[model samples]
Target chain A: MRLINHIPGRPAALLLAALPFIMIFVAYSIASDIRLTANPQDKLLPAPTTIVETAERLFTVPDKRSKEILLWNDTFASLARLLGGVTISAMLSLALGLAIGLLPYARSLFSGFIAVLSMVPPLALLPILFIVFGLGEVSKVVLIVIGITPFMTRDLAQRVMEIPKEQIVKAQTLGASSWVIALRVALPQILPRLISNVRLSLGSAWLFLIAAEAVASNVGLGYRIFLVRRYLAMDVILTYVIWITVLAFVIDWLLKSLSRRAFPWMEANL
Target chain B: MSFVSVTNVWQRYGNRSILERVNVAVDEAEFISIVGASGCGKSTFLRMLLAEERPHKGDISIEGGETAVEPNRERGVVFQKYSVFPHLTVRENLIAAESFDKPFGRLRGTARKQAEQRADTMLERIGLNHVAQQYPASLSGGMQQRLAIGQAMTAKPRILLLDEPFGALDPGTRLQMHDFLLELRDETNMTVFMVTHDLDEAFKLGDRVLVFDKPRWDPQDPGLFGATITYDFDARNKGMPFQDILDQYPSLSLG
Candidate 1:
């Protein structure tokens, strides 16, 4: 079989995507068996059975203290923060991006500033964010916002700039005011791009969210993973990590499909 | 008196001169076609009329307005590409053109119905009623251009500026568009200022054909001055032979 570019049928394509995952599972199972044979209580390599049990317990059973399914709670909290930060950033990016792109004065004022802002490593400001925003949900959400907003704004601003000058000029000739041109002509065109940008920025958004939760929060998938690390709870950690991966994949897929369906005209070149 | 007048207009980009002292007086409902060599300021002069750019010296007055400002509904333009909004369906594009100045681009019940009715009529006129619900991307080049022209005309602009509107179409499609434009102009009595590289197109559709070129070559200050109306021919006068006009401006006559 060729290593690349072979057009596989549906089942084969699914299998091809699942290949690496299956390999990892088998390899880990074999290593776990070996370690368990040597020392049955080894925490480093948990068996598949151990991971499955942990997943079931985490998903179904309630936390002893809070009487809530910790897994679902973590999922909800993380998703809310992620979506909140991303939604705010998307709106801000659209506004500032349109302004910076369409107006010469705004471009001159903000383009360089935004470029420099994006260059500052967001993680480096984590401690300052914690101190300033008080390590609450505000700081966590703000971290994700600050972490992704500048990059998104820059991306969207560049996208706005790339909007053919003809479109803007044509909008003007159609008796559209500047407001109408920005909100109507430019906004609809950039929304699909915004989705694409958010999809690309999802990785960093997850990173900042997890880092924030791991450092300060008592709730979240990240906090749970970090909390269990001292006990060397590899089974729970591995399950949580896989769940997070699944969630990220689902979010990205949903966004991509939404963009494709809602804005079919966007993929003209594709 | 001229309905559209350009007096002593000059255009410069950095040190390069594109247009200089261009004067033209266009009566109401007059179809004017502008032709010139590549980089000879035909499009630049058209841009001035569209109010996309201002002349560094002098002014262009449309319908007695003394100074050209940003493009408005009074002047409609069709570019070679992207004249239609790709995101909107054909009907929506026409409606948008009609409703852009309305509050929030909304037309109330009867107004909305009336707008849709007008859009449908225009769709039928352009023979695009079959694809009224489709997006511009799905349409062929000729169909899309027709939609764009219909969209621009739905707003009823006093003048239409076409920047090589058929430059990208096939020869057959170009001829078809030529007839469509002539019919539309005759029906609406719309004044048109078209810029094209096709001399035949300029002569075929224009009531008055203008050629912009550098009349005097200055070896010392080559870029100091710009193109001007070097030749003006009355296309409505069929007695004035094509070869005679071509003989007057040898640089402008080509395939």
Candidate 2:
């Protein structure tokens, strides 16, 4: 708490510092309000302590292969699809953005199409995608790719356009060919912003992943949530939700750390 | 043939005329300075010579027997703003000039060695040898401009075009740059065309000064933005040195 005071007025740091305590207080309040069943053998309400004990048992018990399989299967499946979709989106968007931004003809030709595509939300196209790619991994991954690429492309293209005209002019004056100028001057200048946009898209990509997995998926965190929701298993749903949050947090943190390490100059500007 | 001939050049932007039927000729190993107010088409004229802008009427020709208009290693230009690439070190900036020799061709082995050696020498000449490995952003404005000059000189161009190269520097550093440029000119004997608003800069470095005034295109009185040969002085005048000519024009004072 004293360390929190040393952070000056950073609201984000303060909020993060308060999160665990707030969650604990909420859990305590919810636990106190639970009602027990009249029948001794049949439990109607599970205590917050019982939920915690169950989670601990799930982790510590080596013999509980079923629980482990249930957790690992969905988690790994979701992660694999998320990674594949994001990777495809990132590569395609970056390449297309650079091309469009650098070349006037490409910009003129593709800009309108891209604008139209960007306006259509990926979720809106999910039904159509499902019809086309079928109710499998391909369809789910494609949906996520479609969701993320447009924003990424727009951000990356805008950053490329914002590269100072003087840099290009100077490069040309120094006898650098168009390709050299694009590769050396333009690419490096936009890299920091591109990395930033990639980090931003990761959140949206995860959101799309969950939404995609919720429909026609048998093995995923989203599927588990759906299954638990049918039976009103709020504890399992909460656990999976927590797991998703942690994974997203870790991924986002890693991306930001990588960005900082790769481009130290970006830190001061940000 | 004059070393560089700009004959009856007219530059315009849309309907507004900037340089109206201007003409000037530069000889071998001469340093010419164009001095004028901000809107008097000094930059436009430089752009015309650099082939960045085409004259609406008239032609520019170089005396070197080359017939076709090519982006030559023969004409090096230094802009008012230090146009050195922020991402590149001074050495990289210098090495980049070699690409102009043959479009899209690589410089390797002994040829690359020679270019590097030349770049190193030029870096030393510009007194930026210590900062050869440093990016332009890390250098002072004066140092960056000097690095730009070094980058230009690395290609060993026949004529150098400077568009108010020291305009952004502070007065003290401006004087230092002026002295270095003069010393460089003395050693290299390369022709230089500079545009400056500062009268002292024109007087100190120019072998001949061209003063531009707003052209009056009244048909009855045809003075326009095109610069006429208002005053041309040979810096090597026996009794009257450049300092004396500068003294004559009190309006061109450094202060």
TM-score per model over all chains: 0.94, 0.82
Give lDDT tens digits, candidate 2, residues B29-124.
999988887777788777767666667888887784432243445668888774676656788778877753444434788988988888888888
- Worst 10-residue lDDT window for candidate 2 chain B reads B64-73
For candidate 2, give the DockQ: 0.29
Q: What stretches of model 2 exceed 4 Å from their correct place?
A: A1-68, A264-267, B64-72, B99-118, B217-255
lDDT values for all models: 0.89, 0.76
TM-score of predicted chain B, candidate 1: 0.92
Q: Write the per-residue lDDT of candidate 2 for residues A148-213, one digit (tens) a residue.
A: 898888878887787765455556566666676667767766777776787788888888888888
User: Model 1 compared with the native: what TM-score?
Assistant: 0.94
Candidate 2 RMSD to the real structure = 6.4
What count of clashes does model 2 give?
6
Tens-digit lDDT string for candidate 1 (A1-270): 777966889999999999999999899999999999999889999999989999999999998998999999999999999999989888888889999988899999999999999899999999999899897888888888899899889888888888888788888888888788887788888889899889999999999999999999988999999999999999999999999999999999999889889997766542
* Model 1 misplaced regions, further than 4 Å: A1-11, A267-270, B237-255
DockQ of 1: 0.63
Error of 2 at B139 (Å): 1.8
Model 1: per-residue lDDT, tens digit, B59-132?
Answer: 79987787767888888989999898888889999999977887566568998899999999999999999988
